[model samples]
Target: MSATIKYDDVETGQQIPAADYPVRRVNLVMYAGASGDFNPIHWNERFAKTVGLPDVIAHGMYTMAQGGRFVTDWAGDPGAVVDYSVRFSSMVVVPDDDEGATITVSGVIDQKLEDKRVLVMLTARSGDSRVLSRARAVVQLA
Candidate 1:
């Protein structure tokens, strides 16, 4: 594991470079198969509309994973993320087309704790809607 990020090198309110994660129908379908979440709303627009959604929506965990990537990428190691949480505030309505939706993830160092650990606050959005809320990750630094 590459835990090269030292606590002293980071500062509170330090902004991590934002990243965009594309989500096509095929991506969702693959995620469904991998996660055993074969919910029709994630793959079928008809079922999604029947449930009163704007269109077929991406999974909440899928959106959360994008935010998690923001933290893990900054930490340089997936295992460095000791804690993570988020609230599903909005839906990521993914359309069935070549150009699908994109989840934009951004993060900032919110706090520096003891033992070379820091709290990262994350924001993930799709289109005009904020899909994830109160997303935070505790990463163990070098």
Candidate 2:
């Protein structure tokens, strides 16, 4: 087990450093194929435009999963997340390029909870938009 992060050591207003998450076209396709979410809006730019979206959009769940990965990496275990939620604030446009779209995720410890838990207010931004709003997670420190 990794060293436990003590809840008492964290400050309420401390901002967690932003972490970059790379989402390539292939990654989106794989996520679609794996998750069986073959929404045309996710892969077909023409369809996305027809629906009034700026460009091909990524799956909301895909973005959420990426955020989950970020939190898990910090906690050193996926199971360490006690709760997590987010509101879709904006769509993540995925262009067909090598750099892909990078989602920058950051968080702040909003409050300390009993029993080594803390409420973390999260932010997920891509390009100039806030993709995940009202985002928060309850993480259990080991």
The local distance difference test score of each candidate is: 0.90, 0.86
Q: Which pairs of residues collide in model 1?
A: none
RMSD of 1: 1.6
- Model 2 poorest ten-residue lDDT run: 1-10
lDDT of 2 by residue, 1-142 (tens): 3445667678789887789998888888899999999989898889989999988888999999878877777667768899999999998899888887989999898988888898889899999999999998999985
Best by lDDT: 1
How high is the lDDT of residue 127 in model 1? 95
lDDT of 1 by residue, 20-123 (tens): 99999998999999999999999999999999988999988988988888788778887899999999999999998888999999989999999999999998
> What C-alpha lDDT, on a 0 to 100 scale, does residue 122 get in candidate 1?
92
> TM-score: which candidate is best?
1
